[model samples]
Target: MIPAQFDYVAPGTVADAVAALIDGGEDAKVLAGGQSLIPVLRLRLSYPSLLVDLRKIDELRGVREDGAELVIGAMTRHADVISDPLVRQHAALLAEAAATVADPAVRHRGTFGGSLAHADPAGDLPAVAVALGAQLVAEGPGGRRSIAAADFFQDYLQTALAPDEVLVEVRLPKLQGRWGVAYEKFSRTAQAWAIVGVAAAVRRDNGAIAEARIGLTNMGSTPVRAGAVEAALAGASAEAGTIAEAAAHAADGTHAPSDLSGGSDYREHLARVLTRRAVTTAAGL
Candidate 1:
């Protein structure tokens, strides 16, 4: 299917991109890697008056270190993200989750920021971002500001980004010490969206779990933090039984959706099961 005609502009700078978006008004759409938006356009689901492409914005396409945090450009490809030394060293959960995003070809073209900005609850990265307590940076006509990953996603296919703002980068605190991370996902196929996914990051102290962060994918309208599970695992024994017990609370505050993939009950079950696996692995038990 052919998309409705739309004017397109490739901006070399974020300032220019912002200007273009503002000039295009409410009908403007930002094109990153086009991994998700292109299909919507082709199906006529979105009829934008203009497309502000950011491919030429070189600043938004790399990984760098800033004090205790790692800064990732919004336009960094999934492949680059998975292989970047800074990402692997500081935020292994991100690389682990990015490795599971579709196939090699899609990963090569999908932008890290694009996936998060797309705000699909089923996407793998948002869960990891939430689990890592990452910060999303956006620039607009007003100025630049940071949005917590927990607040960045609002609902299904929705985000906190203003219409005139462009996501510039993401900041992740470096995980130091005895930290183990894992991302466990249940999908019908390698390229299919997750029916349920769990991102776990555990920090072990001595023989106990000192801290644990758990994020649930497709468990609600947005990526949900497994607060119940995290609380249950705090200072708990880093053993399989203890982890499994905490995993039982995986669905405590979630509102899982029922779809063709599976029923809500089934997803909740998967969440518990996968959370146990992810936490156990992360705890090194």
Candidate 2:
């Protein structure tokens, strides 16, 4: 299917891009990696009057450490993230999740900030961002503003981004100490979107679970934090039984959809089983 006709503009500067977006008004869609948008355009889901491309913006294309936090540019490729030692060493959970996003080909083209801004609940990065407590940096006509991951996602296929805004970067808190992390994605096939996925970061102090951060994918209209499990396991012994006990509430407050992959009950069950696996794996016992 061919897309509706639209003008394309590749801006070399963030300010220029933002101005273009503001000028283009509600009819402009920013293009980063184009993995998601191109398909949407091809299928005519979105018919923006103009497409703003950010690929050539040098400042928006790398992974780096800023003291205790890691900042990833909006155009940073997933493949680059999978290989960056800075990301691999300090925030390994992100790298692990990136490896599971689609296959090698898609990873080579997908961008971290792009995926997050797209706000697809089934996409791995959104859940990972929530699990890691990352902040999204969006730039608009006024200037840059930071948004917490919890506040960034609004609802089904929607985000808090304004029409004139473009996500410039993502900031992740550095993982230190005895943090054990894992991303368990439950999809029917390789490169398939997760029917229900979990990204967990668990820190152990002595034999007890010190703290845990868990994020749920495809369990609701947006990626959700597993606050029930986090609150349940804190200070408890890091064991399968304790984790499993908390895991029972995996789908609490979620609005999972019934689709070709699974029904609502099936997703809820998958949420439970996979939450246990993810928590156990992240606890490393």
Candidate 3:
């Protein structure tokens, strides 16, 4: 389907982009890699009056270190995230999950910030971001501000970003200590959206699990932390039984969608099964 005609502007600077957004008002949509927006446009699900293209905004397009965190420019592509040495060493969960987003063609064009801003609950990166407690940086006509990953996503296809705001970068705190990470996904096909996915980060101390974080994908309206399971895994033995016990609560707080992919109960079942797999792998047991 052809999309409705829309005005397009490629801004050279963040400030210029903000100005364009403010001028375009409620009918403006920001374009990163156009991985999400383009599809919505083609389907006529969205009809923006103006498309503010940020491709020319060079500042928002790389990965760099800032003190104790890695600041990833929102425009950084999934392919770049997958291959970046810093990402692989410091935020391996993100790199691993990015590898599962669509295929090589889409990865080369999809942007990290765009994925987060698009706020698709099934998108692999959001679950990883929430699991790692990353932060999102947004720039708007008012000014710049930081939003925690937990708070950035509100609902399906919805985010906290104001109409005039543009996500500029993402800041992921280094996983201090010897943390093991894993992302487990269940899909019908290699590149299909996850029916249920789990992202796990386990920090081991001595012979016990010191800390564990779990993020659930496609189990709710947004990528949600498996808080009950996370709480349960703390101080628990790293044994398979113990991990399975904790993962049993993976669907406790989720409102899993019932769709052609699978029913709600089936997704909940996959959540527990995949969570156990992800946590066990992350715990290195």
- The residue-by-residue lDDT of candidate 2 on 9-82, one tens digit each, is 99999999999999898989999998988999999998999999998799998988898999999899999999
| lDDT of candidate model 2 versus the reference | 0.91
Instruction: Report, for all candidates in order, the number of backbone clashes.
Output: 0, 0, 0
lDDT scores for all predictions? 0.96, 0.91, 0.94
Best by TM-score: 1
Rank by lDDT, descending?
A: 1, 3, 2
Candidate 3 stretches with Cα past 4 Å from truth are: none
Model number with the top lDDT? 1
List the lowest-lDDT window of 10 residues for candidate 3.
Answer: 205-214
Quote each prediction's TM-score: 0.99, 0.98, 0.98
lDDT of 1 by residue, 1-285 (tens): 999999999999999999999999999999999989998999999999999999999999999999999999999999999999989899999999999998999898999999999999999999999999999999999999999999999999999999999999999989988899999999998789999999999999999999999999999999999999999999998888899899999999799999999999999999999999999999988
